[model samples]
Structure formats: structure tokens, C-alpha cells
Target chain A: MRYKVTIAYDGTDFAGFQMQPNERTVEGVLTKIVNKIAKNPGKRIQIFGSGRTDAGVHALGQVVHFDMNTQMNEDNMLHALNSMMPLDMSVKKVEIVSEDFHARFTTHGKRYMYRLSLGEFVDPFKRRYTGHWKFPIDIKLIKAAIKDLEGTHDFSSFVAAGSTVKSNVRTIYEASVRFDDATQEIVFEFYGNGFLYNMVRIMVAVLIEIGSKRRPVDDIPRLFQVLDRNEARGTAPASGLYLKKVYY
Target chain B: MRYKVTIAYDGTDFAGFQMQPNERTVEGVLTKIVNKIAKNPGKRIQIFGSGRTDAGVHALGQVVHFDMNTQMNEDNMLHALNSMMPLDMSVKKVEIVSEDFHARFTTHGKRYMYRLSLGEFVDPFKRRYTGHWKFPIDIKLIKAAIKDLEGTHDFSSFVAAGSTVKSNVRTIYEASVRFDDATQEIVFEFYGNGFLYNMVRIMVAVLIEIGSKRRPVDDIPRLFQVLDRNEARGTAPASGLYLKKVYY
Candidate 1:
């Protein structure tokens, strides 16, 4: 039987999403618990996530799927899994699904949000979750640049170095930057069919640079023509990135 | 010159607000930085807080006063003190005030906010800042009880055991509970001329019990007459309490 699970995690302590030999990764912990629940059903159960999240990245609705032979119901599985999981991670929901429904391959689109704290001093409570950018930013320039990022385009310049993907073409259905008055936070939300390795972070860095007037607002549209990674600014930190939602 | 400073701190790592012989405290850290900035002006400077906050209690606008023999202006002092203070503590403002001004004695009232996360799954990001209460609550009962807590009353029943204050009488100016639908959090805000030791926490505990139907709704006003500390519910955890503001 196949099961789909929605999970949320604070990635501050995890190495990343993928399983590594010795490091504490989200996948490593999930796999440990899933197999333990199988309880010698003769085969180790394996879980697959919607996508990999980098270290220090958070997730609000990350979806995953796995196969298990146990007769445990969804409620019992959720209770048992959450009871043994660490404090930083939790299983929000679990449901039985058709075997054909794959968590990764059957995905349609995803949404990611990057949070920037614009205050003079970093908020101690939000230090672990938000990227602190104390420099002044021109909100008008950022709004203009966000408009250029929407639509289907080959985001080669925004791809991180060492990414071996053969295709850099991805569709960004929506992109916008909004300032939260109460918290003095700048939030960048991106919705797209897919994203390249560190693509969102790199795009955020360029937007911030443009917002700060360090780079011309026209540079965003110009970078698409260059198709060179060096033409883009540095990638933003992973702490600000959140896997907001996954669609299937 | 005497300086009055507005401060904010994440108390997750501090023992409390007061300086102890060996504990890591907000006052201990602030005093160290102030003295270092003083640079052997001859006497070791001491800091006086508006009041002591218990361990794991956060503060958003705590006021403190101290004397220093330094020529540095407010801007430079703010920069120097913040640069040297630990990541968990920060000085929001520094102003030279009259020597007659006192942080504790000049006070007229204070406002406290206690956050409760009533969801089945606690938000991982807010886990450190809010208290998780998973039990179902009756909002109507809580609202009625909140109204009963306002106004002047002898809150001897709400004081913590071993508190040495001569008078447990305090005036609650405003008390209310508002539910935030977006975060599914219940925030209890209290404004009072003064709060007895653990008074707000105990009040919250009894309110929660009433909300959960574990205790009768009239128990709030009834406890005021009993004047017995043992009559109240257990004190709420310190993690959920925040010294929101101190007024003078």
C-alpha cells in the first residue's frame, strides 16, 4: 500500500533533506522511523520526498510518499511516527494513496517563499528563520524586477555553479515581493512548475542587489540574454528559503 | 550620567533577568558590556532593570537604567553596547536621563502577553516562543472569565508560593484574549498597575482550565475571596510569557 504524508520541519539542525552516511538529515530520520514501524515486515520501507531542501531551509507543506505492508491505519501511523520523531520535525498528515501517485514525479508545481528582515537589528526570535539584510533597499526597483522574472524562460544565469541539469528552462507562474509593515519584513514569493538547484536563492540575491541600487533594474531582463552564471549576483542564504507548498 | 535604555531579549538561553553569581542572565551580560564600555571610569557600573523576568521569559520592551562616567553619545553607546552583547540580547535605544529617573520606581503600569498555540501540531518555528496547549478550549468561557479578571483586586491567591511582597493587591486595567485565526494562536494580553509574582501566569492557567471546562468559570472571582495560593491552578510555563511593555 502507498501512503502520502505532508510534513513540516525546522531545518536549523538538519544537514539537509537527503540521507547521508553520518549526518542528521530529514530523510535519514524519516526513513529510520518508517522502517521501525514496519517491524520486521521482511523488507525495509523506503520514503521519497517531493524534493530535496538545502541545509537551514524550512518547509511548511513538504509532501512525501512511501510503501508499507503494515495493517496500521493512517491515524495510528501519524501518532506513532510523531511520538518518536524529534522536536524539530513533525508529520502533519498521512493518507492512503494509489501506487501510481508518486510524490516527486507526479508533482505539478511548487511555491517557495524567501523572507528578509529589514530591521536595523536582527530579531532574536527570527534570527534562525529569516535572512537579515540591514542595508536600505528601493522597493520600487524590486517591484519592477519581479515583473521581469515571471513567465517561461531559460534561467541559465540564475542556476548555481556545478548544477548538471541538462535543461535550465522553467516556468515561473508568479513572482512578487511584498513588505510586511508590522514585522518590517520583505517577503519574496515564487510559484513555478520547477526550480533549478539554488535557483530561487540566486534570483533573490539579484533582486536584492537591484533593490539596493547596486545593480540596475534592467539587469534582470539583461541577465536572461547573457545566459552566463557569472553575470548573476551571489546566491542568498538558505535560512530565508521555505518550501511553502507542493502541488501534485 | 544616568542612561535609560529600552531592551529586547530572547530568554531561551538566559537563566533569567537578574544577575546571579554563576548563571547566564540578561542583567549579567548587560552589566558586563556596560562596564567594559565604561573602561575603568573608576567604579564598576551596575544596571537596574524595571523588574526581574523569570527564566525562559522573553521581553520586547524592557527598560533599564544605569550610571556611567563616559563621554560617548547615545548613538555611539548604542552601537558599542550592541556590538559587544551576545546574539540573544540587544539594546534597542539608549538615552541620557536625569539622575532622579529610576527604572523600577518610576513605573505606573505594565503590559504582558502570553501566547498559547492550541493547534494539534505546534509550529516548529514558534516552538521556542509559545506555549503549546493541545486541549480543546471553549472560547466563550474564556471570554467571560477574562472579563472577571479586570479591575482592582487583592490577588493573594494568584501569587506564587515563597513570594515575599507585603501586598498582593494589584489593579488590572485591561484583560482580554484574542484568537488569531491565521496562526491559530490564543494571545492573552493583560495591562495592570502591577502584577504579583507569577500572577499573570497563574491567571492564565486558571483561565485555560476554565476554557477546557476542567474548572468552573466562576472560579476566577471566587479565588479572589479565598486569598489562598493553593486555590489557583498551576502556573503556566515561562516560555509563553513575554514582558510586552513597561509604562512609567
Candidate 2:
């Protein structure tokens, strides 16, 4: 039987999602704990994920599926795994799913949130989880900047140059910028069919630059039309981005 | 001239309060930053605190004072020192006080807060600032245990052994416990004339053990009366405690 697990992680201490030989990775840790709980200590389990989140990139709805022959109930397995897992990661929800259910292909839409702490002092408590930008940014300018990117468009300007997507089109259902005074965090939320490699980060960079008055808000549309990666601003750090939700 | 400063810090990365050679100490960082900001770089500044905070112990109002050259304006020095200091250590307030104002001697009351995450899974985001305790604890029992220590008494039973306190008799102003569900944190707030070494941690240890039903809530008063260090519960981790305020 296969089980689908929804997990959340801090991602500060991890190298990335993929399992490396020696470095600490989220997938590697999850696999190890899953194997240990299944009573197959050395068995290689093929864990499938919805997507690969970069190093220092966090996730709340990171869906994964794995098959096992163990008889341990989901509650027991969850408790056992949580006890062995480091404090940086936690299994939020776990359930039995159809053996044919694919975590990657079955997803419908996903939301990503990029958080930037804009204050005099970067919150030391949240230094690892948030990106700090010291410049004063205009909220109105950022709100107007991302408006042009709301509809379907060729998003080559937002995608990383190393992205392997044959088609660069993505339809954003919603996009907005808001500031939280309590947390002193500026959040960018985007709902899309999917995101390109580093797409959210690149878009965030453009929005921040626009908010800082370094770039015109109206120029965002023209930059996308040009389809030149050099025309876009630099990509934001991975720590600021989080996979917030996925609707299947 | 001397300046009184109120300090706040995230203690996860610090070794301890006192300055040490070739180590990352809170006092060491403050000294270095002050030297960098002051004109007299050769002057070894004295940072007098109410007391020493152990490694991994945080503070919101750890009071300190230092004498500097008369040429340095109090406000300018405060701002300059904070600017040059790291993100973790912050100067919350600074004032030019009476020459007799000593951080340790003039202090009248002090408050400490202990934060505990009493859930099955500790949030990855709050791992550094919170102490995770998965075992279920009874708040009523904990409150009853605290009630037994709400007045002036010899806290030798609660204070760690070999603590260099000249006297064990300290007056406690208030001792209370509250839980916040949204943050999943149990906060223990205590105000006293002063504290012995590891006193709050040891008190929290006894309270937590009582709350967990491992020890009886009524046993707390007997421990205080007995004045035996080994009769009480073990000391809680230092990471859970914070110097919340120091009053003068």
C-alpha cells in the first residue's frame, strides 16, 4: 500500500530536497525515518514528491507518496517517525492513498509565498527562515507592479535561465502583496497552475526593485513581453520562498 | 560619564554573558561593538550586569552599564553601538543616569520568563526559542506547585547546588503560569528580588515534573521546607528561560 504524507519543514539546515551521499537533505532524512518505521532499516524506498524545493526553501504542503509492506498503523508510524525526525521537520498529516496516486502528476494548483523582512533590524529569531531587505519599499508600487503578472503570460522573464521547461507560459490565478506589522514581514502570495524554476523568486526580485523605485511598475509587462532573462531583476534568496498549499 | 543600557538578545548562538577570550560571548560582542563605535578604541569598557545569564539563556531587559569618554554623547553612542552590533544583541534603551547608578547594585526587582512548547511536535520555526516537552502536563497541578512558592522563602531547594549566592532568602513578588494555544507555548512568569544560579530552571523543572504527574503538587512545599537540593526535580534546560525584565 502507498501513503500520502503532507509535511512541513524549516529548511534552514537542509542542503535541498534530493538525497545526497553525505550532506543533510530533507528527502534523505524523510526516507531514513520512513525506512526505520517500516522495520526495513536498510531498504531503499522510492519517495515521490510534488516538486523539488531549493535549499533554504520551506514547505507546508509538500506532498509525498511512498509504498511499503509494513503492517504498522498510520498513527504508530507517524509517532515513530516524529520521534526519530529532527526538530526541523514534522509530518503534518498522513493517510492511505491509492497505490496509483502520484504526488507529482495528481496535483492541480499550488500556492507559493515569498516572505521578506523589511525593518531596521532583521529579526534575529527568524534570520534563518526569512530574507531581510533593508531598503524602504513603497507598498503601492509593489501592489501595482504585480498586477500585470496576474493573467496567463509567457513567463520567461520570471523563470531562471537554467530552467528546462520547454514552454514558459504560466497562468497566475491570483497575485498580491501585503505587509504584516506584527511579524514585520512583507509577503508575496501567488496562486498558479505551476511555477517555473525560481519563478517566484525572480518575480519577487522585480517587485522589490519596483517598490524601491529602482524600476518602473508599468515596465513589468514590457519586460515579460521581451522574454529576455537579462531584462529581469536578480532572483531573491531561496530562504524567503515557501510552498504554502496545493489543491488536488 | 556612564551610560545605562537595557539589552535584548537571542541567546541560541551565544556562549554566555561574561566576556571570554577567543569565544563568541554576549559581553565580548558588546565590548567589541562599543570599541568600534567609540573614539577611544584602546579603552577597555566595563559592562556591569545585574547577574550572569547562562549559555542559551535569553534576555529582554538584561541591564548593563559602561563608562566612556565624556566626549561621546549618550544618545549618539547608543545609536552607534547598536548600528555596529550584530542582529542578535540589541540596545533597547539607553540613558545617562546618576554616576551612582550601578547595573548590579541599584537594581530592585527582576523578572524571568520560561517558554515551553507542550505539544507532540514542536514547530520547526520556533525550535531555537522554545523548549519542547511532548509529555502532557496538568496546568492546575503546575499552578498549585507555583502557589507553594509565592512568598519570601529560602529557595535553596529550588536553587542549583554550589550556586554562589550570599543568601538563599529571596522575596518573590509574583509567580504565575499561562498558556497560549496559538503559539503552543506555556509561559512561566516570575518576579523576585533576585535569583540564585539556575534557580528559575530548577523551579521550572520541579513544576514541570509535578504537572506531568511524576511528582505530587503538594511535594513542592515540603521540598522548600527541607532545603535539600537533591530532594527536588532536575534542572530544566537553560534554553527555556529568559530574563524578561530588570527594574531599578
Candidate 3:
């Protein structure tokens, strides 16, 4: 039977989401526990995630699916997985799904968020979860620049150099930047049909530059005209990004 | 010159606030950096804190005082200390003060906060900062129980067994419990002139029992009447406690 699970993880110690030969990855740990629970001994079971989150990136609602030959129910499976998983990772939900349900292929949309701390000093408690930007930011300029990013556009300029996707066209349903006064954090939220590799991080980098007045606010629309990766700013760090949700 | 400094620390890795011969402590690290910045190699400078926080307890506004024979100004000293301190510890402010200003003495009051996650599952991000309790809690019962804890009272029952205090009488200015629906957390705030070795922890433990309906709501007054060291419940863990502020 096939099962679907929603998980949350603190990715500070993980290499990435993909399974590698010797590195500690999210898929590597999940597969190990699932195989052990299935009592497969020598056989390895495959678990597929919605997409690969880069190293040091966190997740709140990452989805995955796997098949196992056992009579264990969803509650028992969740309990077993949570008991065996490390404290940094947890399976929030588990359920038996139809055999044809695929976590990646059946997804309709995805949401990602990036957090930036704008205080003069970095908060020790928030150092691991937020990107620290000590420079002063003009919120009005950031809001104006974010308006040009909503709708269907060719985001080739925002795609990283190593991404090999055939097309850079994607539809963004919503995009906005808001400052939280209590925490002194600026959060950027994006909901789209899909995202390219390092696309969100690169977009955040450009917005940061525009907010700090290092780059012109009109540069975003100009980048769309050029459609060249070199026109965009540098990619932001992975520590600030979080895969917030996956829609089926 | 004598200097007074306010600091904040995520104390997850330290043995405690006090300096020891071989343990990694907050005072040990601060003394090392302060001595290095002072350029006084063999003259070990003495530093004093308001109180010693137990291991794993965090602090948001802990005050300390130390003396140094250097021409470094306040801004330079603050920058130097923060730059040299580890990521988990930070100096919030530094200012020259009179020699008679002591962190422990000549005090007015102090405030502490304890964070409890009431959700069925612990949040992975808040694991290091909050204490997790999965049992159902009655807010009204807790509020009623907390009212009896205010004003001057002999809290011998709440002190830890090994404490050597001459008296257990302390005046509590404010005590209350509130639930935050946004984060699904219950926060307990206390303001008092002083606290015993484990007074706050033990009070929280008994309150938790009353909130969960394991103990009667009136047990607090009974314990106060008895004034026996063994009458209180077990001491709560150190992870949930935070030294919010020290007033003088």
C-alpha cells in the first residue's frame, strides 16, 4: 500500500533532501527508518519528496510518499516513524493514499517563504532561522518592486546557473513582502505553480538590493526584458528559505 | 573604570551562569573575552552577575558588572566583546557606572517568564527554548491557583532540597498565566523582589499539576501553610525558564 506523509524538519544538520551514498540527507534518514519498520532487511524501499530543498533550508509542510508491505495502520506508522526519527525531524501526518497518488507529479501549487532580520544586531536565538541583513531597508521600495513579480513571466534571470529545466516560464499566483514590527523581521511569501532551482533565493537577493537602494527599483521589469541570468543579483543563503506548503 | 553590561544568551550549551575551573560557562567565556580585550594577561579581572541561572535556562536581560583598567570606550568595548563572544552569547549594552553599583545588591526587582508548548506535538523549531507538555490544561483553574501566589509568602516548600538560603520569604509583585492562541503556547510571567534556588521551577511544577487536574487548585495555599520543604511538587526543567529582566 502507498502512504502519504507531511513532515517538518530543522535542516541545519542535513546535507539536503536527496539521498546520497554517505551524506546525511532527509531522504536517507526517512528511507532507513521506513525500511527498518517494513522488516525488509536487505531490500531498500524508495521514498519520494515533492522536491529537493537545498542544504540548511527548513520545511513546515513538505510532502512525501512511499510504499510498504505491512498491515500497520496510519496511526501506528506515524507513531513508529516519529519514535525512530531524530528530534530535529518529525512526521506530522500520515495516511494511506491511492496507489496512483504521487507527491511530486500530483502537486498543483507550492508556497515558499524567506525570512530576513533587519535589526542592527543579530538575535542569537534567531541566527539559525533568519538571514541577517544589518543595512537599513526602505519598505516602500520593496513593496513597489514586488508588484512587478506577480503573474506569468519568464523568470530565466532568477534561475541559478546549474538548473537544467527546459523552460523558465512559471505562473506566480501571489507575491508580497511584509515587515513584522514585533520581531523586526521582513517576510517574503510566494505562491506559484512551481519554482526553479534556487529561483526563490535569487529573487529575494534582487528584492533585498532594491530595498537597500543598491539597485534601481525598475531593475526587476528590466530583468524580465533581458531574460538573462547574469542580469539578476546573487542568490541568497539557504538558511532563510522554508518550503511552507504543497497543494494537491 | 567600573562598567555595567546587559547581556542576552541562548544557554543551551553552557553548564550554567557561574564560572568553574573546567566547565564551559557564561561567566567563564565573558571573563576570557573581557580579559583579552583589557590586555591584562596575569591580572584576572573579576565579574559579577545578578544571579546564577541554572543550566539550560535562557536570559534576555541579564545584568553584570566588572572592572577594567583600559582606555576603551563603551562602543568599542561592546563591539569587541560581541565580536569575540560565541554565537550563542551576546552583549546587548555596556556603559561606565559608579563603583558602588553592584549587579546583585542595590536591586529593586526581577521578572521571569516560562514558556510552555501546549500542543500535542512539540514544535521542532521551539524545541530548544520551550518546555513541552501534552496534557490538557484548564486555564481558569490555573488562573485561580496563581492568585494565591502573589504578595509576601514563606515559600520554603518551593525551594530545592540542597539550597542553603537563610530565609525563604519573598514578595511577588505580579504573577499570571496567559495562553497565546497564535503560537499555541502558555506563558507564565512572574515579578518578584527575589526568588529561591528552585522557587520558580517548583511553583511552575505545582501549577502544571493543578492545571492538568492532577492536583486540587487549593493546594497552593495548603503548601504555604505547611511551609515544609517536601510539600511542593517536583521542580520543572530548566529549558522553559527565562530571566526576562533585572531592575535596579
Candidate 4:
């Protein structure tokens, strides 16, 4: 039986969503727990994530798919999965899914949020959850820059190196920047058809550069035209990025 | 110069505030950094904290004091200390305090905040920052129970089992319970002369019991009269507690 699970993780302690040798990772732990429940070597199965998140990146509504030897009720599955979860991760929901429903292939769009702190220094309690930006930011500049990010665009400039994918073009359905009063930090949200490797973090860095007046507000389109990663200042720290959602 | 440093830390990965062999701790890290800055074996000095927080507990304004071999400007001191701080901790402020101003010995109150999440299941992202209470909580009952907590009292019932302190008597200047709308969590704040080992967590447990209708609304006074730790339901998880401030 195949099942879909929605999981959330603190991500501060995780190496990433992918598994690695001798490292504590979200996928590694989850795989261990789910397989442990199967209790038989023959019933062992592999789990699939919507996408990979880099080391130190977080997620709220990350979805995953897996198959078990026998069908189980959702509540029992949720209880079984969540009860064994570590303090930093939880399987929030579980549901039976079609055998053909793939976690990665079905993803049509994604939403990501990046948080940057404006404090003169990094707040200790927020160190794991926010990326610090010491420079003064003009919200108006970022807001103006965000207008150029809406709709379809070639985001080659934002994609990080080490890409094996052929296409750098993606459609951003929504792009927004705002100050989160409660957290006292700047929040940037991007919803796009698909994001390339480190795309969100790179875009966040470019927007921060615009917000700090290091670049013109209308420079995003020019970067697309240049099709060069060097035009982007730097990738924002992974600590502040959250995979908010993956819409199928 | 004797310097008073206000520090904040996310204690999720710490063994506790006090140092222990082969364990990561807040005090150990601070002492190491401070002594590193002293730069002379002969000038090595001990660091003292206002109080200790248990493993997984957090702090926003915890204060400490240490004497240095030489006087240093506050900005440079702040920068020097903070730059070397681990990701989970930060030195928020440094001041050249009077020789007599001891962090733990100064006669004043302290402020603590306990965060309890009302979610049916633990939110993984908040696992390090909030305690989960699955039961439905009545804010009014908890609020009423909070009133009995204000002012001076012999809080023997709230003290943990292993406390060796001779006096359980302490003055609570103020106590209040409020719902934080932004996080959808119940926040309990206490200002007092001092707190015993695990006192705040025990009181929080008792109050939560009251909110959940397991005890009388005015049971706090009776718990004080009982002078027994068993009277409290259970200690809340350390993750929910934060040492908000140490008043000198």
C-alpha cells in the first residue's frame, strides 16, 4: 500500500532531507522508523520526498510518499510514525495514496519563504531560525524589485552551480517581500512552477541586495538577461529558508 | 574590570547551563570564550551566572559576570565575545560593572516565561521552543490559578526533588498568564526574588492541571500548605521555559 505523509521539521539539527553515511538526517531517521514498523526485511521500502532541502534548511509542509507491505489505517499510521519521531521532526498527517502518485514527479509548483533578521547583531534565540542581515534595508526598494519577479522568467542567474538539469526557465506565480512584525524580520515568499538548486536562497540574496540599495530595484530582469550566477551577490543562509508547500 | 554580560541562548543542544565533563553547556562555552580573551594563564578568571537553566531550556536576558585581566571598551568586548560565540548563543551586551555587582548575589528579582502550545499534536518547528499540551486548556481557570501565585510564599511544593537549598521561601512580585495570539500559545510570566530548581516548570504543570480541570482553580494555596513536591502534577518540559531576565 502506498501512503502520503505531510511532515514538518525544525531542521536546525538535520544535515538535510537526503540520507548520508553516519549523519543524522530527516530522510534517514524517517526511513529507519518506517522500516522498523514494517518489522521484516522483506517488507522494507524506500521513501520519496517532494524535493531535497539543503543542510540547515527547514520545512513546514513537506510531503513524502512510501509503500508498505500491508495497508494500515491513517490514524494508526500517523500515531506509529509520529510517536517514533525525534524532537526536531514530526509526521503531521498520513493518508493512503494511489500507487501511481509519486512524491517528486507530481509536484506542479512550490512555495518557499526566507527570513532575514534586520537586527544589528544576530539574536541568539533566533540564530537557528533566522538569517541575520546587518545592513539597513529599504522595504520600498525590495517591494519595487519584487514586481519584476512575477510570472514566467528565466531564473538562470539565481540557480546555483552543480546543476545537471537542462532547463533554467521557471514561472514564478507569486513573489512578495514583507516585514514580519512579530519576528521583527524581513520575510520573502516565492511561489513558482518549480525551483532549481538553491534557487530560493539565491533569489533572497539578490532581493536583499536590492533592499540594501547595493543594486537597482529593476536589476532582476537584467540578471535574467545576463544568465549568469555571478550577478547574484550571494546565497542567503539555508537556516532562514523554509519549504512552505508543494502543490500537486 | 568586572564585566556584566547579558547573553541569550537557544538551549536545545545544551546539557544545561552548568558545565559537565564531555558535554556541551552554555557556561562551559562562555567560560572558554572569556578565558580565551583574558589571554594570560595568570589572568584566568571564573565566570558566574545569575542562575542555571536545565537542558532544553532557553534564555533571552540571562546575565553573567567575570573579571578580566585588562579593561576593554564595550563595543570591542561585545564584538570580540559575540564573534566567537557558537550559533546557538550570543553576547547581547557587555558593561564594565562595579566590583561589588555580583550576578548571582545581587538582591533582586528575575523574570521567566513559559510557553505552552495548545496544538493537538506537537508542531515540529516549535519542538525546541514550546511545550505541547494536548488537552483542551481553559485560560480562565489558569488565569485564576495564577492569582494565588503572586506575592511572597513558601514554594516547597513547586521545588524539585533534589534541591539542597535550605530555604524554599521566595517572594513572587508578579505572576500572570496570557494567550499569545501570534503563536497561538499560552504564555505564563513570573517575576520573583528567585526561583528554586525546576520551580517554574512545576508551577506551570500545576497551573496546566487546573486549566485542564484536573484540579481546583484555587489549589495553588493548598499546594503551598502541603509543602510536598508530589502535590504538583508533573514538571513541564524544559523546552517551554525561558529565563527572560535577571534583575540585579
Predicted structure with the largest TM-score when compared to the true one: 4
DockQ of 1: 0.51
Model 3 ranges off by over 4 Å: A40-42, A225-230, B227-230
Model 1, A1-248: lDDT tens digits are 88899999999889989999999999999999988888885877888999999999999999999999877888988898888888789889999899899999999999999999886777777777888788999888999989899999999999988888899999999999999886778999999999999999999999999999899998978999999999996989898899999998
| Proportion of true contacts reproduced by candidate 3 | 0.42
Interface RMSD of each: 1.3, 1.7, 1.1, 1.4
Ranking by TM-score: 4, 3, 1, 2
Candidate 4, which segments miss by more than 4 Å at Cα? A40-43, A69-71
Top candidate by DockQ? 4
Clashing pairs in 4: none
The reply for model 2, stretches above 4 Å from the true place, is A38-43
- Candidate 1 residue spans exceeding 4 A from truth: none
Tens-digit lDDT string for candidate 3 (A71-175): 889999999998888867888999899988999999999999999987667787887788878898897999999989989999999999889889999999999
The C-alpha local distance difference test score for the whole of candidate 3 amounts to 0.90
* Model 4 chain B worst lDDT run, 10 consecutive residues: B37-46
lDDT by residue for model 3 over B1-248, one digit each (tens)?
98899999988889989998889999999888889888854678988999999899999999999999877789988898888988778888999989889999967999999998876676778888888888888988989999899999999888998888898999999999999887778899999999999788899999999999999999998999999868785887798899999998
Cα lDDT, model 4, residue B127: 78
